[model samples]
Target: MLLGSMARRVLANAEGERRAPRFVFVIQSNGFDAVQACPESIPFQKYADREKFEQLDLTQHKLPKGLAALEPLKGKTTIVQGLSGRSTGGGHSTHGGCLGLYRTSPASRSAHNATIDYELGRAAPGILPWIGVGMSAGQGDALMHYTARAPHKSMPIILSPEKAYNAYFSVAAGGDREKDFHLKRNLLDYMIGDVKKTRRALGSLGGEELDAYLSAYDELAARQYRLLANKDTLGKSAPKLDDRFTSDVATKRL
Candidate 1:
């Protein structure tokens, strides 16, 4: 939620006003001990009120041993504490509630509502609003929705590195990858044309429902155009494929 709010602020700035900030979020499912982040200089009693909010100057105190790696970025970093997750319903794992802040079951395949990351992704539009890559606890699970894009819709987390590489960086790979990209663009074009014909056939019968579908296809077609325009940049930044991408080890996929 904090990242989403910050992204909105940065995006709201007029051109040349301020540079956008890059944000990365890491999720660890293992249990977390509050003391691991609590500085040695601060007393535990200060965090007794879980609902309260407190901010401290990192310059005046040392970060806990676990978070020492953030020393270099202390100036831009903020550590928040005492935020309550009472509504998440305490358990071995909060499932979708970990991000949605509402009770959810691990067995469920859909989300109750949009997650913070989804809202952030939408606020800062892109060809692919968001991409999730993570290891799944279930054996041989190559994809999972530990997150959501909207209510009743779960965002996919690409668990296979090979699949992830192709999904994001394939346009730069040339050969089959580039061919696949063009094929998808062509498919979208066909779909848009078909939808237009259908809408026209419906005439006065068509309502916001048809308009919504048309608008979605239009946005997708626009993304393809943007991708083609930035092909050079994509080629320059695409990661080189290697053994790790196809490694049998689950952690290597990350």
Candidate 2:
């Protein structure tokens, strides 16, 4: 969610006024049947001819049953196939390696070195770099997934839509901006002092790491202050809340 928005923002900023390309990745837990998604108008045997590349004009052909819902978006929709994921270890799940393009196993430590999403997020920084949302079946409040942040670091997905909404959009919702700014300012001041105290107690190497962390917090605080200063502008673009945000059904929340 965050990645998509950031990408959109990047595209908007690139061309001064022209619309930019946007990307969205809709990943499902269970695998999807590729055959079912293929257009019936295209001969399946054509795929067997590895000697030649084939392209189909989907605009002239009826969409596959699985993709019928996208009929309205035919002009913008694209169907790409024949990509291989053989290099990624396959099981019930690929864990972090799915996006990282590395072999990651449950038993292995430091398996996921890096992921494409995080790399992209780093390249295009936003108010919220990345937002991961998921729905678990019978997990009972436990948000377990194979996503990763960095090597040996598993990223946590927000399972609850309400929580996700609050995390990302709360600032844009109507509120007393002055009060919020003061509260955040006080909190950041306290955190800076605490980080300094902790750094003083640490050794040289640890202190250096703490210094970096503290600097990051300082940068974040500055960004937050700037955002709060422009609360009126942001609030105009805030998303409207509805029942789906608080729905218990995973699909509704998603």
Candidate 3:
């Protein structure tokens, strides 16, 4: 009876599982020379006393079959490479290799948003949103997924597995959608007054300008209405994160 009650409670609270879960993952970027996860490929492991200058012909670890299994989802997943913040302020950290992504390091920046996931997940005219997951929660440092300097806000990284699981419901089902409807209604209401005012203002300026402005307004309104009707078709589906894939990405294995 206790088990049944617990299961019932969990189900009741499971936020609507509306669609496929979207996952965003951030990890400490690695260098090409990084050792593979396979034990056999570890060059540092064999060294009893290592000299800084010593060159080790190390073997590389290969990801297991479970990872290769994801080849089926290749089209769904777009592996983007070679992007960075426009500038790093020339700080020594600026000289940073792939490790530079975290913004601040040792563990690296947690929540800076520029890295692909958050951008992709953003709610827009037509797109699936994003959820950032932290795969690089090293003990010494903080974990955040989205990181942007200054004006850009940092997106908190999903740390706990439960947090990640719950977020799946949030993004998948389109969290607080009712609120969005209310908000859109309010926005349209607000636009009604401003739009009329703009028309009047344009008339005062000149007949030609008034006609052009109204025409532009009509075009804009049409675009907004189109977006409203076809919201689902507007964006790419958020990436479905498989556990095996996450494991492969972590530890520089991917």
Candidate 1 has an lDDT of 0.73
TM-score (all chains, Cα) for each model: 0.70, 0.71, 0.31
Tell me the tens digit of each residue's lDDT in model 1 across 194-254.
9899989999798878887787788668767777877887789888899989888767754
Q: Which lDDT tens digits does candidate 3 get at residues 1-254?
A: 53784576567669663343355443444322223322233333423354444333212233323334434553343432233443533244331222234444445534333544444444322222443455544622234323422123444555544445433332232556434544554576566657668777766665665554455555435544554555455333434444643343455422
**lDDT, each prediction:** 0.73, 0.65, 0.42
TM-score order of candidates, best first? 2, 1, 3
Query: Which has the greatest TM-score?
Result: 2
Clash number for candidate 3: 16
Comparing candidate 1 with candidate 2, which one achieves the higher TM-score?
Answer: 2
* Every model: Cα RMSD to truth: 5.5, 6.0, 15.8
Q: What local lDDT does model 2 show for residue 218?
A: 80
Q: Work out how many backbone clashes candidate 1 has.
A: 0
